[model samples]
Target: MGVTLKDVAAAAGVSRSTASRALSGSALIAAETRALVEDAARRLGYRPNRAASALRSRQSHLIGLVVGNLVNASFHTIAEVVQRRAAAEDYQMMLSITDADPRREEGILRTLGEHGVDGVILIGTGSNAAASNALLSGGTAVVNLIRGAAESAAPTVLASDRDGAGDATRHLLELGHRRIGYIGGPPGTNSGDERFAGYEQAWRDHGLPLDERLIERGPFEPSFGSDATGRLLARVPEMTALFAANHEAVFGVLPALVAAGVRVPDDLSLVCYEDISWLRWWQPPVTVVDNGARELGELAMDLLLQQLERGRGSVPQARNGRTYRVGAQLVQRESSARPRDV
Candidate 1:
């Protein structure tokens, strides 16, 4: 016969009940005893009968992670961190991509709920207000990640994007770049709006006019960067610097800048709204506003787990409502410099 719980307990020199408590992650069991039982289970190749365990616990031991776009660098890191955190608690994570499509997000939310996910962690603005409200009041634990107060009704964790963007934009202004071109995601998304607010706030604080002619708004597509940058530069020839709202757009902006004969920190200084590793190695390393995506993911999942552990209203909230804001910082690199006189 294959190794069973009894066999594992016998090997660990502990009573069956003690071994069971250890294996079940009961804190009442001593740490040494838990380690010993885990070691025995590993050596004996003892696998718990999940079906029976599920019947006893009434939990699927599964979590659903929903993201607007999988290809986005930010979501990729977030998903990785979520999976790792979920697994540590003996919970498995299931991923769903909505492509930021409202209808698709709506359908997927229903699907995940119907499939009996113990909890959900969603990124970006939810699909529809009705659906979001339904799920928020549906009594299932849900933690919204990466969205701001305007989009979230339940517990949420978000990057301090407005502050990050404001800081980066201010840096460009400080470098004496009078004409700064801005490229970002469409206006509907709370994230995009907040970032734009940061850019606007910086100009307001510095008593500078934000030239509407230099701003480009589009979908969060890599292609958008090139298309918009080309158009912006062609129209506003005096524009000396560019700011992109997300990492994917940076890829698009670079090729367009190259084609236009613009040299980083020479002919045209540049800064990115989002930071990723490869940017550091670019010929003139890019300056960026880096909000720790991985940390955000970890903190978000931890909040969801807390909700699951104690049910709704267990997680703490601020005076106004439920929101956790992760901070961001500006990374200065060679990509930014004072504008050269046209």
Candidate 2:
């Protein structure tokens, strides 16, 4: 038989009630006494029955984390960070992968709700506002990460995509590349729209003519990247620099560049958004704008905890919206340089 609260209490010379309170982390228990009880419990290997505790407190101590896909390095980092943070807080995390499908995301949200999760954090599919709102209305706290649903008012955490993209564009512009090509994501999404806006804004700030023909936007896939690279190269053969704003697409972009016999920082300077370990190991290590994936995950967890502590309904609604942003940084590498003819 496992060690029980009675055994721990006897070991600590405290009552059974005191041992239970201390293990539950009650504020009413004196610090010294609580420490003593906890030490005794640990020595006795007494594990609290989470099922019994949940029955008494009505808190499952479980948090649900949902992401579109793990293909994006940033999402992978965010998932790791959040899981670590949740475990540190003594909360178990349930992870769900939806592949960015709206129907799948909606079903996951509904199932998480049915499971009585204490809270939820998700990279929304942008089409599941109704399901998210239902969770909120049912007194469950929801925090949106990376992508925000248009109709839901859940607190959101995001990286500064616009600022990061602008910084990347400025880096290429500063290197004397006027004819720059851009490969980006589909329009209407937060990252896609804001990143393109940032690229456009940087050109305007530099007083350079924006060339529409050098831009390509499509799904975040390797095939899209390869096809887009071919089309951009054919249309703008004189393009001296390229910004691959979609990290997933860069996989395809690199192979296409190799097939075209383009040498990095020589034939065409390249900059990518989002940092990954392999990026630094590549020949002519790729330059990138670091999106602060870990920081974004930490901030998202913090916001969710705050809402949970305040009681979801008690969290004051923001006048506009509660959105937190982690800043982006530019990391230079051997992949970018001044245009050869410049």
Tell me the whole-model lDDT of each prediction, alpha carbons only.
0.82, 0.89
**lDDT by residue (tens digit), candidate 1, 7-91:** 9999999999899899998999999999999999999999998767776876778888888876578888998898898998888
Candidate 2 lDDT over residue span 29-85, tens digit each: 999999999899888888888877777877889999998777789888988888898
Worst 10 residues of 2 by lDDT: 312-321
Model 1 Cα shift for residue 184 (angstroms): 1.1
Candidate 2: list runs displaced more than 4 Å: 1-19, 26-52, 314-320
Q: Give the TM-score of candidate 2.
A: 0.87
Q: List the residue pairs that clash in candidate 2.
A: none
